[model samples]
Target: MAALSKSLLDAKKDKLPAQAAEGAHVHSSGAAQVEGDELWDKLPRTPADILRHAIKGAIRAFTLAYGARVTLAFLLRLLAVLRKKDTILGALLAAVRSQDGPRFGAFFGLFAFGWKLVSHSLREIRGIDDRWNDFVGGCVGGLAILAETPERRVSYMQQMSVRALQAIYASLHSRNLVSIPHGGAWLFALTGSQVMYAYMMRPETLPSDFYRFMVGAARVPDPILRYNCTNVRQGQVDPSIAVDLVRRYKGTADNLARAQGMSATPGVIPCAVIHPTSDSCAETNLSRWLRVFQMIAPVYASLNIVPMLTLRLKHFLTAPRTLASKAIFNTVRSSSFLASYVTIFQLCVCLHRNLHGWVERVFGRRMADSRALVFLFGFLNSAAILIEHPSRRVELGLYVLPKAVDSLFRIMVQRRLAVVIPHAEVAMFAAAMGAIMSFYQREPECMTPMMRKLMRPFFGRY
Candidate 1:
């Protein structure tokens, strides 16, 4: 019995240190876990992170556009199917036999490549810390559109140019040049660029043999202004473009008229009229208008998210208190802001028209022909801001004033005043924004949550 008790005591003493060590190990693991979580919470989210997340969201949303494009391309081929020329494997073989088949494949291929290029490049161009993904995007934007024919190639470049412009616009916001809501300034940079490219960008000439293969062999229809609407089915020139081309390229209307089996008499003989496919004036006009609307469709799609998100956020925040009143107020206010941007754009368009008109009347030439008129466009665009609603005008002022101040401040700080301002660049953005908002948003009710905190010192008790 005494021997058994001694053994039991020794066993209990050995167990004590093991249990203590196990408890200490558990406590240390718990502390380490808490420290890791704290470090994660404190880490500053970079602009790259925001962009990365936004892009991922955009990819999820991109299926709609990609599917639509593929569907349209497929549908356009159905006419060939109905003619009973070839079916399925036969059609595939036929396409493989010709250059047009490859051309069709190339357009979509470059388009996809261009899309990828622009997406990645945009993020890279944002700053010095650009990642490989963004570098690929920009390079893709620049080089992807290159193809066999100049006309098709230029058309592709136009799409890329618009995308580049959009990237620049979005980059401006990302750089804090503009305060577009919910960080949405970055979302549609790609889509809007695509739209603008489709509408306004055109290559002046056809690729001749290459175009012929795409249209005749491939049965792909030529876009409306391909060859400037020249090359009638009878192999004659079109009147619309012919009249201008004759004066510029072929010498004169009378010269072209006499050369093209018509009387040389200027007043009597009509200019070249090459009608293709019996397509009437109405049909041509309708086709052109449809393409124009297609360009606008993406613009609408890209921007539609903004108002939706703004109104939703407004509703969510103003919930459970005077919801009806806020709803009515936000409906008018939010929508007007959206419309104000459109209005500003429309006003610039009008300015563009008027400037062109004045240039034509005074200078006897197109506004596009003059470099001065082009420069004036930037100035006119600046003036268009004040033309918005009063509240919108105020918001614009608040937005611009800070950036303008920061511009001057940075210059001063970078020079002799560097020592006076220990860290001007670091604090300049928020301090400037707060100062401008203080003066503009005197009414505390109008302030956002962040703005409220910022303005607290300036407007005490409010």
Candidate 2:
């Protein structure tokens, strides 16, 4: 009995050191974890620390935004060299040296600085952090738009307003408070109708760049469109103008003869005038679509790839195959959309010409080259928006909606139907930015994926 008791005591004593070491190890881990948390907490606990962090963040934002802007500019200039015949290396160098190139960076940095300064100051003053702080901070921060060119301030305002409105709608959508089934398609159709009508009848009312884009997409010489528009306005077609245009574009013999023989009475613009190079509208549309796709694919590819290479180098490096595949897919998709847009628009016009005789026979009246027919064809072509991915439809609609509104606004003002409000763009920008930041901090999930990706560089985590 005595030997057994001594053996048990020795066994218990042997376990004591191992248990002590294990407890010490756990305590050490706990201490390290607490220290790590303390380091994190130290970052924004004091005024000096907050200021240091904000400045550092602002600098980082500037670098990221500036680098992105410069990279995009270089790529665009390179495209210009290839497509638009811009001077090669000189244009690139000028892009780098351009004064406006750095303004985007300054805008981003100043906005970050202002947001941090205001939000943190509010927190300290109120002894609490809340959504209101973010709203106020964002409004104040948005004034940094002044850092951009006066012309760009309005563009920025319009884009941000659209995005903010989208965010707000998304937030409401989450709770089932509102919904718009197929809203993107409807919006695109509605806005696109106005845009195309303006392009045909009142090109001068459109923005210069947008006007140029339309001209290119239509694949028609500007002189022909201008001539046709004038005829429509004057309620008389001048065959001489069409003949001259066909001659200028090196139209086929049949087309040239057709243009020369057109009646002075009002008539629809001919397919020959729209696609002067080919006799058959169907063949021209098919070939032109292929050509446009080839031309536009490279531009969209650069747009997608350059941004990834510049901003997300780490991800690109980690999974080059995946990223490259995605970029290529997106490029093809976007290029297809643009190509289809052009093809469909021209096709609609050709179809209208083909069907006009049947309609006149049925109604016993000529359509008479009315602007209303042009508007109808324009509206019909918007069906091409369906070619794009459904997810991107709303984004595309939002993008074009502002341009349409701008055109309509100008038309209204010119006709004395509306008055311009001074500094309205500035006010709209501030308010929209406030709403954006509030949604960003409080419910980032409400923002579109692209918008969230865009804001992440400057705003960081919610």
**lDDT leader:** 2
lDDT of 2 by residue, 1-462 (tens): 334434433553454333222212222256654543343233253567567767877897888888888777877778678776787786778778987668999999988887877776665555445578778988998998989977788888988998898888888899999999987888888888888888888888887876997787667777888877876777577788888888889999999988887887645667777677899988999997998898789788888887689768898999999999999998999899889877888887788777767766775444545667766766677787787777688888888888888889999999999999987888888888889888887677888777877778655752
lDDT of 2 at 76: 73
> Candidate 1 lDDT (Cα, whole model)?
0.36
**In model 2, where do residues sit more than 4 Å from their true spots?**
1-45, 80-92, 363-370
Per-candidate local distance difference test: 0.36, 0.77
Give the range of the ten consecutive residues with the poorest summed lDDT in model 2.
19-28
User: Measured by TM-score, how close is model 2 to the native structure?
Assistant: 0.86
Compose the digit string of candidate 1's lDDT tens values, residues 263-379: 222111121222232224334334433443333333333233223233244555656356545444544444444343333323433344336445556766433333343223333
**Which regions of candidate 1 are displaced past 4 Å?**
1-74, 92-133, 136-158, 173-462
